[model samples]
Target: MRYEEELIDEVREKNDIVDVISSYVSLKKRGSNYVGLCPFHNEKTPSFSVSRDKQMYYCFGCGQGGNVYTFLMEYNRLSFVEALQELAKRAGVELPEREQTAEEKQQADARLTLRDMNKEAAVYFHYLLKSKRGTQALVYLKDRGLSDEMINQFGLGYADIYRDDLYQYLKAKGFSDYQMKESSLVNIDTVKGNYDKFFNRVIFPIMDINQRVIGFGGRVMGEGEPKYLNSRETILFDKGRNLYGLNYAKRSRSKSLILCEGYMDVISLHQAGFTNAVAPLGTAFTPNQAMLLKRYTNEVILSFDSDGAGVKAALRALPILRENGLRGRVLSMKPYKDPDELIKAEGQEGYQKRIEEAESGRMFELLVLYGQYNQQDPESRTEFIHEIAKKLAQIEEPLERQTYLASAANRFMIRKNDLENLVNRYGLGYQYEKVNEQYKTPPETEERRQEKKKSNKNQPQRLLLTWLVEHPEMYQYIRAYIGADDFIEPLYHSVAIMLFEQLDNEEKINPAAILSRFTDAEEQKEIAAIFNTHLKYGLSSEDEDKALSDVVRKVKLASIEDEMVHTSDIVRWQELLSLKNKMQKFSISRS
Candidate 1:
């Protein structure tokens, strides 16, 4: 069962929407509402609005709107239950323990089972690392400069040579085969049955932000073709969405994050007291991971290996970090392969110094480009200058772009105007429009464009829905005349049906309450757009009545016209014409 309605009401009352949103966004008072740039999307203008009286927020640019719960769910990517728990904590509301419904219970059990299985596997592997079976692995870790305390803190463990040791242990512990497979800890063979996914390797448990063990990574102790093996994508784990050691890194309270290339680099950095270090899980950095990092720190330092592949990876990550509004810097690890080797040779202080001396992303890219060609060669210099111009053009700030342009001119001994022109030609600063000479709006083509223009045409329907929700007493009168079938747009249709049903059930027509009925983010956005749209002209009681009558007539006329197009028989066409005539007469009478 869900939380008690009284408790939900109390939570909502205590946690005002403006107060909650103000913590994440810098909202400024604009009339009765607060306005800020949208956190969901990158924008310069303040299109996100929060209403103190209505207890809701809406982004006109992105169309994301809802109450505090919707904001938490979208901004933090949390589930409804998770958002509720978070709000309950903030509101200081004591939640009564209740029994879960069968479906909820099953889902909770599945997640708990996976977490418990991973925890047990971590423990079992840790024991093996300390046992005689893990002697060589322990020696290997020691050679890599890992102390016993550091190993224990990181939950480092070893999987023995036996293929099904973990499999047998988990099975004996009463874990179901399905749970094990779902956890991605065991692989099921068609003929061989189930076997451990990690063997003859040292295991590193990957955890969620809450520090719950979700998956594992294993590095082979001895020589192997594939030296590192990570958990496959499963219900509990997505490799691209997770970063290794983030659970610990976030607690460092550091102003910046050190994004390394591998598990060892992150672990080594943490062991060296630079706890704010995280690495992607066996894949290149992703936009999701970049956005996640933006939540923890304002700056990110890329500390990949000093190899060609690592430089390329860093280059790719630069734009992603910029897109997510995080400052990215590059740590030059030349004369050393990675952080692990650098820390091993020069200690923590040396690594810290290197971090301090790290260059900005643009500077790093320029340096890398400079190394590719000799300046004495005229053709190579031209190509290099153009490449630098393209990179400089991507910088949005005028002052920043000017600074880079000046630097480039000084370095290449070229006129800054030539480079600026090249940047405008190749970079995002360039604006080009193509004219289509054969563009024509046929019936089918117009229908295709209807989705874009539906917002304008359906304004009356949206206003009617909004008015019905704002004045539930009017729902009875509106319901007698119109139904959800009158709404042409699916989004508005869904909202109308929900509003009618909610009114019939005597439920409050609140944004939060209405939002709870929807699970899709897109649907929530549309609902927010409907709620945020303000009527151009004021609707007094008399005006509201006329507006409702006019909208109903318009809807009926549209319905008739739509039916007339589909009607094949003479009788159906005549009936549609009669309905249209009656709607027009009713509209005239109401006016």
Candidate 2:
């Protein structure tokens, strides 16, 4: 069973849509609604709109629209129950105790069990690190300049060389073998039952944003085949979705995040007073990680190693940051290997100086281009100028693009006007202008408008859905005349079925309530677009009835035509024709 309807209603009543959305988005008053840049997608113009009266939000740019519950679910990546629990707390509504379903209970138990196992394992590893067995690992950490306080604070530990050391420890702690295997801390051995996953390694506990130890990273103390081994993906841990040291970095409250390469680099940076530092979990940066950073900071300073591989990784991350609507800067940690080495050699103050001297995304790209081509060679220089100009032309802001163009011209010993002419001649300027205009409207809204211009094919079906949602009382009247199968588009048919179902159960049939039926974000956005586009026209009660009848006729005619195409028999084809004629007659009579 879910939360009581009364409790859900109470929570919804207290949490106004506008108020809830304004916390994440800077909504500006526009008519009776609010408009802001969509948090779901990157865009310069404000296509995300909120309707206070309707308690719904729709982004014209990315097509993300839903109620406050949906906003929490999508924005925070929470489950429905999780979103509900959070909103109830914020709304000062107490959620009544309800017995969890078998599946819910099982999932909850699994998460708690895995987390407990990880915590216990971390404690055991820490204990071993302080014991005689970990003396070598402790000395190694000390030699690397990690103070005792840093070691204790980071919960650094050491795994024993014996495969069954942690397994026996956890077993003694009353954890079952199944639980151990599930935690990814132990590997199941066919003959031996279970063995520790990490052996003779330094342990680094990987915590979630909530500070719960969800997983672990183990680094081989000395020479080993695999230098570092991270926890496998589990229910509580997704390496692509979670960043190392974010739990601490978020507490730094810095305006910018220092993105590093590895776990040690992040820990070392934090030790050197750069607390707002995070790293991916033994993997290259991902789009999900980029979006996660955008939630915390507006800008990211890429402090990857200055080595060739690190440079390539930093270059690859630039576009991901841009696509996620986060500004990026490249930190050139030259004359050193990584942040850990740089901090050790130059100290925190020297590292701060390097951060300040970091290059902008465009300038960094130019620098990378310059490194690839020697300036003395005329052919390489020409190719470099053309490539740099193309990059500059892609810059959306005119001033920023012009500044970069000037910098490129000065660097290449060419006139600024000549570069500008070249960029314009390449048609990059026109393409940029087109993209800028496209961002002003939601992609779905534009496509719908273009579809309308192309033909009146799906217009009536879309109109029927909008009218039914806006006027739920008409559902019964419309149901008497037509069924969901009459609708041509699958999306429209789905919406029609949901609308009738909600009305049949005597429930509210607004966009928010209707959207809750769908789990897919894209499907919810599509339904929102259906309501958002047609509702703007403001059809009256009398107009709604007439429009509904006309649309039903059109939908029935479209459905019949579709059936006729498959009707090979002359009798079946004639039957479809007669059905279409009957629909036309009924529509004429209703009019």
Candidate 3:
């Protein structure tokens, strides 16, 4: 009925499901269908299957299944309309008359205008740096030993001294104060109204993993009170989660990720030919940031500043990395306090050598300082060992802890047996696998329940729902065989009912079709994830006789279970047999 829906229908009619899917996946023929490794999630074996007759695909491994349109949405992270438009272009289909709500139209227009503003601003600043006005900033960057390639790679720019310059430019280009604020390109002062936050500074754009300019970071041209300035928090910018230069780093390298303290360190490392590098925004290292790094490289080399504060920060971050299943190590830089200075002192090759020599340290080693091991009094030493042994027991690795014990024993001139006895006294066992399991869970407590509740808030349901919408042919089969009523979990049940009802009557199932029915965006997401998990199996051509018979038997059993306590339990059974005999004689006449 809608223009977008009509467009999607046309695209689906024009493009064969197999043709579109084959573009991204390596499909191998097996009997009547094709099989491949699931591209959505990391897995070694093939669970992804495509059926030409059904015009759908499924993954048994990840449970992601769908038609060509759904494949594009998940693989490329495109919206429904975007995916439709792309398929239409490939299929050569003309779109129908378009209509969008006034609010939707305005938001789309605002994003376009903001993008233009950002592009123009980035180019303008780059031009300013080449001009006489940008000489001071250019010299300052060079003084920091940044190469021209490095500067250009980061899209380094300069803002004029006047704060109103960017503000006026953006306003003239038809961006509202709110739009500029959303883009994180402008800041508002109570007295000054709107102004450029990066005025009179050299700018480095902070990009997402996809390399889009989500926000900016600026450093003063010369010595200023606040030496470095960065974009304020906005809708498009989240400093705690984003890393600089990861977009390029992920594409260029596959080995390891270099985690540095500052944005400049990340930029400088990329410039030095160590392409696999990333750095967090102003916030301290987070569990989320650690998990993100794990996607690209399980191994992480941290290059914190060589100061006391930096050492303490690294120590604090080690536990977070270990908890997230990343193999983390520390890069101790010599002859310089920071990564930027170290890279500048030694050429790129010198920095590479240090990264190679990086050493892995247990969290306890960093937390306890060497002085605790060498206390003058034996009692203090014993107490120190007990305190640290408890912490080491928290570590999930068996051999790693034993290795630490052996090393600690050698350093403290204590017998290995004594160290092992002390560790056992604290109930820190030597079994890495079993010990890791003990550390996995805290006792059932109110605080732990609250933490779980907080985490459940961020679960991705829309992704699951979208997957379901993509695979419509499986609707009847899933309902008949799997039974929507079997889903007892609240979140899964809500999605199952919605999906079952959506496909019950429709000739074709489009996930976007049901988006209008649910006002809650999170519900839409949950529906998507549900489909994603189910689509992995797709629809089977296998006979449903057994499944259907089982359902009937269950229904019969439920009736017996419900009537077990009748008013006249024995007489009720005789009455039921007489009623069945009478009903059978009437059925025989109809036959």
lDDT of 1: 0.81
Model 3's alpha-carbon lDDT is 0.65
Local error of candidate 3 at residue 476 (angstroms): 21
Q: What do the candidate models score in CA lDDT, each in turn?
A: 0.81, 0.81, 0.65
- What lDDT score goes with residue 423 in model 1? 81
Tens digit per residue, CA lDDT, model 3, 434-538: 436423543678876884584353222332234346545534443443444544345555655766676676756544333323434354444434444422333
Top candidate (TM-score): 2
> Candidate 3: misplaced stretches above 4 Å?
1-107, 172-178, 188-191, 222-225, 344-349, 363-368, 371-379, 428-591
lDDT of 2 at 319: 79
User: Model 3 compared with the native: what TM-score?
Assistant: 0.60
- Model 1 TM-score (2 dp): 0.74
Span of 10 residues, lowest total lDDT, candidate 3: 582-591
In model 2, which runs have C-alpha deviations exceeding 4 angstroms? 9-77, 91-99, 189-193, 427-480, 483-509, 517-581, 584-591
Worst window of 10 by summed lDDT in candidate 1: 431-440
